[model samples]
Target: MPSPVMPTSRRADGHTSPAAVSAAGLRKSYGDKTVLDGIDLHIPAGSVFALLGPNGAGKTTTVQILSTLITADGGQAQVAGHDLAADPQAVRAAIGVTGQFSAVDGLITGEENMLLMADLHHLTRAEGRRITTELLARFDLLDAAQKPASTYSGGMKRRLDIAMTLVGHPRIIFLDEPTTGLDPRSRHNMWQIIRELVTGGTTVFLTTQYLEEADQLADRIGVLNNGRIAAEGTAEELKRLIPGGHIRLRFTDPAAYRSAASALRETTRDDEALALHIPSDGSQRELRSLLDWLDAAGIEADELTVHTPDLDDVFFALTGPGNVPNQPKESAR
Candidate 1:
């Protein structure tokens, strides 16, 4: 398998470069209720860092604060090498944002939306047209450049939304559920676009309700619960935090199954299926140990399979009781 892409630049000594976004003691509140309670983050440049949490868990609040849409009640933040509080303009210039809703102007042509974004960025008329054409073509909307955005499909409109965000060529992007309402095919396409952005040296800070989206895209993930980050790590590292991982051995011969069960004291047996479930983290050492034990007993059974807790399990364990945001109300169909 190809190795996963590393978003951050590393030094010769193996330490990471300076962070693209950093926050210390970030806090926010509305009226008597606190939304974020002193959270800190250090996201390296050129990496995809996903922040996950249930609805109303302050995920949106955190994004709003970081993106300069709202001020934090307490704490400090820097984005793309600019101090968020002191230089909001600089921060704005260095980052792009695609929120939960589409920003495209449905009444206007797709090309017009891109041009509007270019105009907002102050690109000259010729330059605006150049970049507009470029982005429209890049997003595969070249043929539909003159069509009203309202006429486009959900996926097409989303593609245009992101295309507009890129008009400024910001180094860092904040994607708030970019794939929330997209079809599987569209969502996959968005994933590819995100990967391409990171590959080209852009840093992405993503917030998503989809666990699989985070697993597939984020180099590192942070689980937010109760206004704080409950856990943070690579997908596999996070999976290791939860229990229920195991290796299962199945034997066709009842006698062989019983003999193996006798040798292994710790196992969950299924007599009907002649299978033994051994508790394991599914690590290499455990697999080798099981094989060694079986060889010593001169027992050759049938099949072996390993099972590990997926991100969905980890998300539930850390976030407590909450439904994963349902697929968008509208189907891809």
Candidate 2:
């Protein structure tokens, strides 16, 4: 463990904000297998930072180390203005974690589960009941408050799990694949809940396998591959790093297709489809110029489409093939 230091960072809104979580040269190893290799992170307060990586890429391991569930092999980190190594208790007090699996007790009622969390956090009897009631209402679990958690839907269980994590009112939260088995509607509902949490000024550190989840929720995203970060930036910034943007022009007439193809020399011709794929950045100025060129060349395309690189493209381009070595049987996520 090393002394922690806070670093100033910019949020997605382009405003300077204090770092809620900062780590430098973080490393972790299990036996001969290295999980994290000198990773550095600086997350601003009141923002969502999503960590995207394939399985066995150490996303969970990073979350474990930062949440103080396990000690890092080497690193210095600060969470909520407290030194992570020097004051892990303080760090724990400032953060909440909702892991992949649900923590709700199936045997207990939803309200009882929340009361249990309140008890763990040392809340008084009256205070615990108040908070439990409020959270159940907030998460739409009030109607089923007295119902056994085992009878609750998957979404209700997850909501209860997160509600339990919020019992202490932490400033930072780490959500590891919060919507793993949720339906599309439930997932969207969860997204709204996360948005509401961030809106209230909580910093979120998310580790998710869903690319769309990251793109929709994260202010910034980091892709980890082979025990290292392959790339990190805003979703659009990461998309721009890959080179797949293009304009597709389709002509029903073969003669028109051939003529358009000849006019547009810098294009990949799809003879069978009667289409031409021209490299483009998808900028308005570029599109205008291209349209003008086509007009001048007397070319009329049956269809035109603009294709831009998305998070999926960036994810594939950055995290090539996953190659993780065997680890000890005791190793747990």
Candidate 3:
């Protein structure tokens, strides 16, 4: 077997590289409201880094600052290979953005829309047509190539928007809720495309409202609340930070339930459900301990299932009303 790889403490990538994005003590504000206060982020190359946050929590602001759409009030950031302030042009040239709104114009054909992007990128006419044709087939929009975007479904439009973003061949892409309204199948399709980009050695900085998207795609995820990172880690690492992650033991009979309940003293008993909620992380060590104890006590559970805390728990913990204003939310795309 390949050697078991260890994740960096603050990285989502199984293998680390010099950061693709790095910001330290970043700050931003709109009027009197401080949207960002001393925020810091380090996103490495060739990985999906998800920045999550509640509405009005500065996710857009952060993206804008990093992408050079807006200037920051304080702090410093680096994107791709250039510093944000000193080389905004270089950053722009190296990154592509698919923002919250569908950038695809409904008035134009899908092929035309892509051609427009290619033109904006300064490609020759023949080169523009080639990229447009390639992207149309790549995004599964070949049949709709000649049709106006207004005729496309929500998913189709999103895919086309992302396709247009790639016309420039950017090394880093920012997707701000790219899969906002797609159905399950469409969402998964977009996920596949994002994975393809990363597998081909691209860096993705994503923001969205769906926690499952982050879980499914992010190499690393950071919760941004009140303009600062409340917590950051891989999906498993973030889940491990929350409580109620455990192994559930279900008994077929009241007798078995009672016996198992007594045998596992630390487990919570639910008489009506005939189950024991053993408080533990579903780690191999914990599983072994539970089984060893059950063997020694001559008791058996009819069924056993492992449970882990989801992002919902992490979101509430870090960004609720009572939070210290540095929590992160889950935004997938």
Candidate 4:
């Protein structure tokens, strides 16, 4: 078989790079129930790739296979430049994983837990202490470092879990539903942390059920459904894949509303609200043309807004009941 790892190339941002993670036709099954079905992925260095899906959609299974925590029943993968099957040890050394559940040892002090991770990575005692101190302070856990983790709030434990994951300085990190239970503020804070990691040249593989999380964080997103990738693209691109985009015009003056309604034959009229909905892709050219047409017709609208499909719309259309999966667009390397 050909190599799973591709050659280094330059990204649009002029960053010299190679694939941080790549896979092809990866498959896994639990008895008769197949999880991943011929899945493919290519994530570049220093980028975030979010896999989005509902529960039991194989997000964790894919993470396990790529992270070498479990073996795939078929296909190949390379992570951090090491062939997954041939050099799992090397792959393990270059990646860190923080699963959906917090890995904090609540019975121990937060500092002690950091020290334990430091030891697992085989750092010298002095080195361990130094990293543990820096990480705890960086994560703003210094005040609670000596306190039992059981006393920490949900957000605190989550932060501690990530700090522990960073103790090894892995280039690629797999975060499986990292913000599942975090409050809004905590979730935003975690998003900032993920951004900083990418800024510092770390590749992140995130799996999330939150459409907003995937929309905000991922450079590209792959929507998984029924053991397959329903579609894959940037948030805007995926949104464009579905319909329901339009331009809405509202008028306070009854005469203007009637005039516009008479002129625009294709618009859907809302007599009660004096609003008109015109089907549109909401592109710049379309908006300009619409404005010109209205001006020519001598019609003035009090309020105008363009409505386009968002990630939530894209998700439901692609993965909802009775929906057929679209062939995934080729992902950028």
Candidate 5:
């Protein structure tokens, strides 16, 4: 992996802090509606930390506060080694934000957008040209560089938008639903770019309603619920926390299925469907026991599949009204 570029925090006198990004008891609210309640986050210098939640779960508000685009109601957070409250400018300088909405201007040429960002960062004319040329090539937008951004495809526009954010060479980036309206191919492409960024040691702060996005890109995931972190861990750990996960055994005939079901009386039955859902915590012990039971029954299964609740289960269980909706969004942004 590439080394991270983020710096540590500041000294009391004037130097930067030692941590890449740190927060303790961060809080924010709108009127009486509390958006973030005593939230805590710690992101290392070169890792991707995903923040997940349902829509209206305050993921955007949290991103806004941490990126210095908005203030927190209470609590402290440090970014790029600078205290958010004490040095907002330093935080802004060290980080890039690709919001849910593309920042590219539709009327401008692709190359012109990159130049605009370069100008905002105050890069010299020669340096700006170098950056524009490099980013356009990197994002595969060179052929379309002279074309108006409005003419670009959804994927191309998204690519250009993110490339523009990279013009200043920020050490950390905040991506809020960067692939919201993209098709599967475009979303996958964005995922690849994000992976490359983290591999190159850029810290990624991602907020998305898509659990699949977090599963694919996050080094660590934090589930936000009711303005708080209900859970935080690696993807596997969170999945293990939920129940109804199982291993399925497919049989060639009804007799074999019936015999197996009889043998494993503890497992849940789906007779009409010719399948059995054995409750599992996704553990090897359970799998071994299941295999042993099958062997003892002398009923060989035609096929076997491991079933585990994904981030969707985790999200709905932890955040919703305790119900998983049939919304077709099992966390793929």
Candidate 6:
């Protein structure tokens, strides 16, 4: 518990927006095994920062430390402008955490669970009930408010979990694998909810096994590998880190294909299929240059498509083999 270090002046959007969460040289170890090794993070206020890592790569541990659930073995962190070690209570007051597992009380009703959170936040009876009713309606749990949480579907229970987290009106929320075990539709619904949260100026720290989830919702993504951040950037920026990006052109006529292939010197050719794969970053300038070359050569391709390295590629490349561990297979997409 040292004094929290001040965040660096670097801004995500090139403006002066304050950081909602900042950590420097954060380290954590379990006995002889080190989980996190001097990690640094700077998440801007009112944005979604998704941390992507293979199983057991210290993602949960990072969230736990940031949310004040556990102390970092070594580091300085500030959450919502409060020092993590020096002012955990103030940090807790400013943040809400929804872990990988649901916190819904099955024995109690959904409304009761919300009331319990409200009580924990020291809300007055009238205020607690008012917030409970509003949250139930907001999460589409009004009809099941009085029913035991055990009877609710996985998606409904997750919604309730998030709704309960909001009872304290926390400015920052840490969601660790919030959409696990949910159907595609339910996952999409959860995404919409997260989007709405950030739209209202809330800062979100998310960790998910689902690469698509990070790709879709995160304003910035950090890929952790071997107890360190391998890369950090926007989805497109991460994709650009890998070298497989290319533009494929296919021609139905062999003559046209040969002519195009001869014009394009740096291309992988598939003579049997009459296709050529030209290395590209999928940038507008490169695509336009390719198109202009085809037009000038008077060669028409039957099809054209761009292929870029996705998050999955970046994950596999950075983490390598064996580090992936036990993540659900479906989430790799």
TM of each candidate vs. truth: 0.92, 0.89, 0.90, 0.91, 0.86, 0.93
For each candidate, the alpha-carbon lDDT, in order, equals 0.89, 0.89, 0.86, 0.90, 0.85, 0.90
The segments of candidate 2 whose C-alpha lies over 4 angstroms from its true place after superposition are 1-6, 11-15, 253-256, 295-298, 322-333
Please write out the lDDT profile of model 6 over residues 168-229, one tens digit for every residue.
99999999999999999999999999999999999999999999999999999999976789
Q: List runs of model 6 lying over 4 Å from the truth.
A: 1-9, 321-333
Predicted candidate 2 versus true structure: per-residue lDDT over 207-230, tens digit per residue: 998899999999999999988989
Give residue 98's error in model 4 in angstroms. 0.2
- Model 4 Cα RMSD, 1 decimal: 5.1
How many backbone clashes does every candidate have? Answer: 0, 0, 3, 0, 13, 0
lDDT of each residue in 1-333, candidate 5, tens digit only: 343344454444886533567888999888999889999887766778899987888999988998999998799887886778987988899999999998999999999999999999999999999999998998899999999999999899889999999999998999998989899999999999998888898889998877899999887899998999999988989988887766777776999998888877667888887888677776788888888877886778887778777888888889868586332222210
Best by TM-score: 6
Output the better candidate (1/6) by TM-score.
6
- Score residue 158 of candidate 6 by CA lDDT: 95
Worst 10 residues of 3 by lDDT: 324-333
Error of 3 at 322 (Å): 5.9
Residue 216's lDDT within candidate 1 is 99
Higher-lDDT candidate of 1 and 3:
1
Error of 5 at 195 (Å): 1.0
Give, for candidate 4, the lowest lDDT window spanning 10 residues.
Answer: 324-333
Question: In model 6, which range of ten residues has the least summed lDDT?
Answer: 324-333
Model 2 clashing residue pairs (backbone): none
- The predictions' CA RMSDs to the true structure, in order, are 6.4, 6.9, 6.2, 5.1, 5.9, 4.0
